[model samples]
Every structure is written in structure tokens, then in C-alpha cells.
Target: MPQSRHLATELPGPRSRALMARKTSAVAGGVGTTVPVFAARAGGGIVEDVDGNRFVDLGSGIAVTTVGASNPAVVAAVQEQVAAFTHTCFMVTPYEPYVAVAEKLNEVTPGDHAKKTALFNSGAEAVENAVKIARHATGRDAVVVFDHAYHGRTNLTMAMTAKAMPYKSGFGPFAGEVYRAPMSYPFRDPEGMTGEQAAARAIAVIEAQVGADQVACVVIEPVQGEGGFIEPAPGFLPALAAWCRQSGALFVADEVQTGVARTGDWFACDREGVVPDLVVVAKGVAGGMPLSAVTGRAELVDAVHTGGLGGTYGGNPVACAAALAALDSVERDGLLQRARAVEALVTGRLHALAARDSRVGDVRGRGAMLAVELVGADGLTPDPALAAAVAGAAKAQGVIVLTCGTHGNVLRFLPPLTISDELLHDAFDVLDAAFAATSTTTASAR
Candidate 1:
């Protein structure tokens, strides 16, 4: 088998089109999709569709499969655990695998200080729980988040999130006391502004609008994921963390998309030396299984009474077993180094592409998590249509890509670490062709 993408027919082939028709009738309209093909099976870096078309999986299911979709170790662990037992509800009957996963999270997450872990079912749930812990511990109410920050979709998380359409539209009357502040987006910020300066701007907003002393926690993604893969300027994180400490607000790092070696480090916060007091992690943790965790300082997390945080399937045995195996694979496979290599390779191609094309406004992100922001002729105005067109063209060529950003003008990549270099180069070749074609088509249409 060729290890890369191979298109057997046009995208959304006969089988996929029929499935789509069924989906339109059965699935809720609120739940949308990308690529428009039905995945039959996936492994390593290829997602094979029902029609037998294979796609170079650059999105990694929104950065959930860092250890690969069908990681052998994860599959084996899950199978063994499932054969033994599926779920007993840890809260009802404590389990060994659940405890083991907590121990692993406490040890691997940043901070040498004594820490504890609580498992959850999704990033949004974990984030909401993290806030509950912080507010309970500090005896405060306000939660601070940054502009372009994507925490999650639950009511509380939606309140923390910045975007309006799709995520927040028609979902009003959100949870209260969640405030937004400016982020140190290097690309969009004033060119001369340093990260320190940016942090000061945000701090001023918090102090004035929200009153820092009243805040319970300031949650942030070390590298903003859905909001365009924006990596904040170097000093920004450290400064915010410092302010949180000084103001008695727990600094929470939402590591859902950037954790578990996806960003060339165990967690992106480690790269900035910013040790968050409370860390919420999901996405890439269980190699494709659903699992999330809130691990942080022992004192803060323990402040809440026993049984304060839990869910029916927070840490199912099979999921925990998969997580343990996935964490092992990260260390054993040297995925951290692999992600860095991906960053170097992909960014090199993107930079060259940006140099040749004025619409390629910026190339940003860290490790395997990267993005290319599309723009108009002015090189500053967002060009979402162009981004959509490029992604569509790439999908037509059997390379699955994704787009994000507040304006939806950024093309993001999250290829599994196990993807071969050959596939990476080939995927870029398709992207280059897609960009050129889309730009020409857009120009001709105009």
C-alpha cells in the first residue's frame, strides 16, 4: 500500500454522497463537517474513506490523534481493557487505571510542586471544572480569558470563548463573570509592540474592567488552537502568569490542543517556562479515545470538597488504559522531536510560499501545530473565501486540511507525528498548487 494519499474518485464519491444525504436528514444541522467524506478507517497518517479514497490526514481530527488514529499500543491497551471491563463509573467504584492516569497527568504536567488530578470527559467539561475549583479555592467569581481564545463549547466555556458565529451564535445568556482581554497576537498586534507591552495592555483591561482582585483564574491556551494557531509573543505568557500570581488569581493553562507532545514539548507551557496553577488537557491525551483532565497544584484542586468534580464516564477504564499507552508512546517514539521536525519542515515550505504570495499574510504556530493566514492584496485584510477555496482544492487532491481564525482566514495543519516525511512534502505540493489555483481563480472571477 502506498503510505500516502490516493484518490480513487472525486471527493464525496457515490457512497459518501449517499451518506451525506442521510446525514442531512438524520444528523442535527447544528453539527457541521469538513472534507464531506465518510471515514471508514484510519491509521498513522491516512484516513481512508468509505469509497476507498485515502487522505493524508493533516488535521489529525482537530489535533486529537497525536499518537496516530489507530496507534498499535493504544489499540492493544484498549482491547485488553475492554475485554476485561468497559466502565464501572470511577466515582461509584474507583478503578486502578483511572488512578494511574491521574498519577501520570500529575507527574507529566508542568510544575514540580505537589499536584493532583481529576479526570473529565471533554476539554470543555474539564475547563468548567477547573474554573469551579479555582473560584471555590480563591473565594472569587470572575474568570479572565483572552481575545481569540477558544476554551470550549459548554455554557461556561462559551462564555470564556471570544468568537460569536457558529460557536456562540444563538447560544446567548451564557454564564456570567467571564471576561475577555487582549492577547499578544504577534501577527496582528502593532509591529513595534513587545509581548511585555501587550501583557500590560491586557492587565490594564483586567484591572479596570474586571478588577484583578476579584478574579478567580485567568485561563489561556499556551498556543491558541482554534483561533488561528496563534502563538503569543514570548513574554506574554510569563507576564500574565505573574499578574495572576500577584493578584491571587490561579493561572490556568488550557492545553487541550497543544499538550501531550503535540507542540514539541510535553505541554506548550513548558516551552515558555510558564507553569500554570491549573492545567486543563484533552484532545490528544488518549490517542483518539475521549478523555480530559484538570491537573494542578495540590492545595488548589483539593480545596473543593470530596466529590465536587466528576462525571459518569470521566475516566472509563478503556480510555484510561489508552491514555497510559499513548503517554508511553510519546516517550518511546520520540514524538516530541518528531513534532519539532514537522514544525521545521512544514514552516519552511509555508515561509517559502508566503514569500512568493502576497495573500499568504503570516505563517505561525509551534511544533506539528501550524497555520497559514490568508489575506487580500493589501496583505492585511483577511481573505476567508480564498482560504476556503484553497482548503477545498487541497481536499480534492486527497490531502485533508483544516481552517480556523476569528475571521476564518487561516489554514491550520495538525498532521500526526507518525506521518512520513514523504507524505508531508507531497501534502505541501498539493497545498502549493491549491493556493496558486485558488488565487488565480479568485482573480479571474473578480
Candidate 2:
């Protein structure tokens, strides 16, 4: 009954098993789940399953619930909005909450330039609209992306994403005119390649393959989220942004997973003073409410004629209210500082683990967005099986962890910013135990 994790039964116990059976029958096969247990309640750092098992949440619902899954302020705002009205379709009736949320986004997002904001239902929708606006403004055809990037799952975003298998495989004939550029992954880069050199490499390819003038936008996740939490080499982002400006191509920052204090900054671009032309935001923006947005230069955003960029449920009144509350919580609660503290706590432990375990290849990321890549005995070959074993081990011990990366050899940790230091340390304890156990088991098997 305590807030901390307490297992009354094995994971996916009798009640959870029954619900899983029901879910299998009702939900489509493509809709995947990380854990078998069904959540009955979740708050702070713990999720209580239907069978009375509590888990320390490290994934934060893939970085959506930064202020906590059941933040009181967000809940109150949603309740108040619902009491007034649910939805009148913003395009038809229009509401103040939607406008207020947009105004907030314009104010908080980087840069002092004249800015405008448009809301959407998801990260994919926001990215799609950003690309649309860029193409319209530039009158260009091609969009540029990067390797190991994860934009979203929609057709246009799928084309933007770099990985195959789960995201792109079988979903072919993707939207055309999307070009992929090499990213500056520090851990995997050539021995002496500087960030500037890496940028030049990608720029050279962009110029030759996708003419700069012919490109509409160069979209990137300042800190690649689903792509192994890859933080570009120090100067990589600044160089890319500069090139985009010189080439008359807009630089878009997909901050879906890194925005709203997740990376200890308003946006990951802020770390290097790289102010993107267009910023796509979601995930943590609404405190788990379904809301996403595109905020950018007023001129480029207004380039599209009226009625060209809106959706019926794009900025649902309820969701906007939640966003407003969530943003307030971010600033009021000082979640930015908390995110940085989490980075120090997690990365410090991970670095120690790397020293002990050969399988732990690299630990990287900013603030609360951190990851440890698993490697084989050679210390260079990706060991996805080890990552899976570690994650599974953590889950079995009542700590929720998630794995990511194109190779599926990275363990990503995105605990809510509101999580207590005690809970965070406890989760790390579980992860350490998981890694130790997995290492021994693998060695014995070998």
C-alpha cells in the first residue's frame, strides 16, 4: 500500500493475465505493449497493476508524463475544462484555452523572434505540418533527415525516420523527397572526427544528393530520442542550423521527447544556442494529455494561407487546459533543475557500471534523457540480447525500464521529473542488479 514498489504477486498475476487475454482479443496485433501487467493506478514514480504489484516507473510513458502521470494540477485543469465544455471543434467554435496554449508555446519556445504556434494531436501530426509549412514557404520539394532518427510512425514521418524493421519495413512506398544524412554519433564516429568535420560530411552529402536549394527543411531531433538517446556531438547541431540558414532551408527541431524540461532545458537546441526555424513539440507538453504543436518564425508559419493548418481535434480544449497547467507546473516546480539532477544521478551510476561491465559500451544523453548502450565482449559489437536481458530482469524485479536504438542495444531511462531522489536511486538499484545478473548469466552460457 506504500508509494514505493511492493509486489504482492508475480508480474502479470491472475488478474493481469485475465486482462491480457481480453486485450489480445480486443486490441490489434500491431499495437505493442512493454509490460504484461495492466495499470490500475499510477502516480509519482510508481504504477500499481491490477493484481496489487507496484513498479518504479523509469520510462515515464516514453517521456510523456514529465510532471508525473497523475499530477494534481493537470487533473484539476482537465476537470475544470470538462465541466465547462469538452469539445466544440476549435475550427468551428474556437476557445480561449487553445489560444492560450498556443500563446504559451510561443512565449516559452526558444528565440525572441516573432513566433506563431499551431497545435496537433500527436508528434507525427506536428512534424507533418512543420514539413508542409517549410515546403510551402520555400517552394521546395525535398525534406532532409538524419540517420538513426525517429520522427514518428505516419507515412511522412516513417519516411523521415531512418530505422527499418518495426517502423519502416513492410510499410513501403513511403513519402518521397525525404533524404537521409549521416548523424554525428560521438561514440561510433571515426576516431578523430570532430563535430565540425561530421557536420561537413553530412553537408557535403546533402549538397550533392539533395540540392540545398531544392530542400524544404532539414528536420532533426536535437537529441535523438527513440534512436538510442543519441546526443549529437557538441558542434553538430550548430553547424547544421547554420548551413540550413545559408542554404535557405529551414532547420526543424523535433523536440517531442526532449522538450518541456525533459533535457534540463526548454529544448535540446538551447544547450548549444541553436535556435531552429521550426520546433515540433509534444509528449511532455500536456502532462500526458494528447497534444502536440509546431512553433516557429511567424513569417514562415503564416506563409500558409488561412484554413491551411488546423484540425478538428488539433487543440482540444481539455488538452489545452492540461497543457497550460502542465507548463505552469514545469516552471513552478522547477522541473528543469530536477531533470539535471536526474542526469547526474543516472549517468554517474551508469559510468561506474560501464567500468565494471564490458557489455556497457557507452553512456550518453542530457538531463533526464539518458541511455546506456550494450555491447558484446569485443566492446564494439552491439549486444541487443544483453540489453533485452537487462530490461527484462529489471521488469521482473518491479522496476519499469525501456530499451531503444536502431540496434535495440540501448537501455533508456526517462523517469518523471517529479520522481523523488529516493525512488530514482531505488530504480537504479534494480537496474544495477539486473545488469549484474544478466552479465553472470551470459558469461555462464558462453
Candidate 3:
């Protein structure tokens, strides 16, 4: 009966603890420990835990539910699709929703040139398939990826990913011909190189080590999501696209985290006016229904043999229906503009905080995909311990925030684009309080 968000107890109250114990017995051994909260239902910006505690959702189910939890149109579409039929598996018999979603992707994704699309079940699958398309088109085997990037968990994508902890520690003998190159992390790069200089250096490495002739594709996240919400320096992406053009290598933009209006633009690559040969989209595409796509240059995409692409569950009818609804919501509600509004709000607040605390070394990101990188007073040394403590303390205060990056010292914000302005401000207030509570001294005092 409550309309306002409320936390009746510390998160993961007693009832949630009991449920988690039961879940552990049935779940996998590798599952991360639950946050101890059992959700009864969620709608629009709020999630109600089983213990009657209401919390504003900032993570958006890891950036999937951008239309907000249980969006009306999405729910309606899902319900209608379920009643009609759940799975026909595009590979099995095919359906209208699958093709319709593909048509929409081709229409919306950047590039006036002809394009084609293939549906998949997750971002990783879309990425892996994109690589396949590039390889088939170029008859090359080598692929180049940036350091600190997180593509997906599948064996091939795992090899593509740069992090080592949970994603690739014991998973050995990963897919071959995947090479790692330094990303444009201006915040951490040696000798404060300009964005153009950084791009040249990375391009040089790719040309020298991999011999672009042997490379099928060069994959990158326009705004590195898991690697830290690091936006490529100006001229970086366009330069890479130009080099890819010159070298005859496919340029793939992994927009798993930056697509679907999550960033202020429809796609971060578009913001720079750079059109990728292949774009991998998912996570927020279907409003949390598990749909992904590789919208690519038509010639490269069509290069694959008839049976070379597709999966049994790649374009499930339900997920297709959900994707239509999600896209509609983004357009009808003007969520792209809403995302920019959130960026202004978050960046303004984070900048103010950074000015007072040297620990807050940087505030960088585009649209609503914002993050704060914590560092020591020197602004050169990462302070993962403080970042963790702040995140843990924020959770204790009933605000849900997430930490990411190779160093694990970046706190990224991925609030739903549909989140209300009031809720957005309230979340900032909670962050301000968390900052205050966690601070021992100001930059000047130290």
C-alpha cells in the first residue's frame, strides 16, 4: 500500500536470508553470494523486497531493464506473445517478431549504407557471431581487443576479454588468434598522451604485431563498460575506424552496455559520427528479456554461408516482442533525451564531489553511463579499498550502487532511462550522504 520508497531493515532482511539459503542448494557453485534481498515485485523505478522494503533501482538489473522494471508496454507485449506462442526458435520455423526486430535494427543503427542483422540470445553471442561474420568476410583469423574490456563469459568471448579474476582465471585453452592492445585510458596512460596520440599508438601496435592483413576484425567498446566507464578520447574511435577502412579489417563496436539509449545517444559510436562495420547490441535491447543482435554491414554479414549463422533460441518470439516494445518505449517516451538529462545531473554532482575530495580522482562517462574513479591524493594511485568501502557503505544506507573496472576502483552508475527526475535527485542525495559518511578528511586537510 506504500507509494514512497522505504527500507524497513538493513538490506537482505531475515526473510531474504532464509530464501538465499534455499537458493544456494539449488544453484551453481560459482554463483556470487546474493545481496540478501528478495523482490516481491518491481515497477517503474522501484523494487519492493519481500520484507516490504522498497528501494530505488539504480543498477537496472545490470543495465538491462532500461525501460524500468515491469514496464507496461513491455509486459503487455510479453503477455500477448506468450498467449500466441512462446518459442518457435527462428532456426526451427521462424516468426514475424524476429524479422521485424531485425528490420528495426537496420533502420535505426548508424550508417546510411546497406546493413543486415542477426539475432542472438545474449551480448556475448552477438559479439562472437560478429567476429564470425568478419572472419568469413575477410578470410582472416586474428582479432584485436582492448585491455580491461569485458566482452562475455563464453569460451571465445572469455578469450577476447582482458580481465583475469572471475572471467578467465581457471578457464584455459581459450579461443586462439585473439590479441590484446592498450585502450585509450587517458586517466592512467603513461605521459598524458592526447587522445589522437593514444589512438595512433594502439593502431601502430595492431599494425606491427598482428599485421592487419591477418586480422579479421578489431573489436572495442565505444565506452568501455566493465573496463571502467572510460570514454574513448576525442578522435580515438574515428581514427580507428579510418585505419580499419584502410587496412580492410572489420571494425566492430561492442555496445552491449552503451546501446539502446543507455548512453545519451542511440549508440556511443554514433555520437562521434563513426559508423562501425558491425555493432553488437544487447542488455537493455529487450527490456530485460534476453535478446541480442549483430547489426552489420550488409556485404560482410551476407558473406557467411546460409547455415553459418543462427541458434535455436537466438530470436525467441517473446524476446523479439519485448525488443519491439522496448524500442517503442525509447522513442515514444523520448528516453534518449531523458538519458542526457541524467548525465547532466550525475556529472554535475560528481564534479562537485570530486572538487572537495582528492579521492574522487575523475568523473567521466557519456549520457547516463557515468562513473567515479577513486584514487589517492596523488590522483595517480588507484584506491580500490576506499571504493569498496564507499560502495559497501552506500548499500548499508539502502542505496544500490555497483563497482566495476580492472582495478575495481570505479563505481559506475547505470540507472534506468525511464527513472523519474525526483528519484534521480534522491539517489544523488543518498550518494552525497554516503560520500560524507565515508570521508575522513578533505583534499586540503590532508
Residue 437 alpha-carbon offset, candidate 1, angstroms: 0.6
**Model 3 global lDDT (CA atoms, 0 to 1):** 0.88
Winner on lDDT (1 vs 3): 1
Off by over 4 Å in 3: 1-3, 190-192
| Residue pairs whose backbone atoms clash in candidate 2 | none
lDDT of 3 by residue, 1-446 (tens): 33346889767888888888888888887878424588888887777888878877778888899888888899999999999998877877889999999999998898999999999999999999999999999999999999898999999999999889888999898999999888998788776687788889998899899898988999999999888888878889999899999999999999999998999888888898999999999999999899999998898899999989999899899999999999999999999999999999889888888877888988999788999999886787888888888877666666678888898899989988878778877877888888888888777522
Cα distance off (Å), candidate 1, residue 134: 0.4
lDDT of 2 by residue, 357-384 (tens): 7778889998999999988777789988
Candidate 1 residue runs with Cα over 4 Å from true position: 441-446
Per-candidate clashes, comma-separated: 0, 0, 1
For candidate 1, the 10 contiguous residues with the lowest summed lDDT are 437-446
Task: Estimate the TM-score for candidate 3.
Answer: 0.97
**Can you rank all candidates by lDDT, best first?**
1, 2, 3
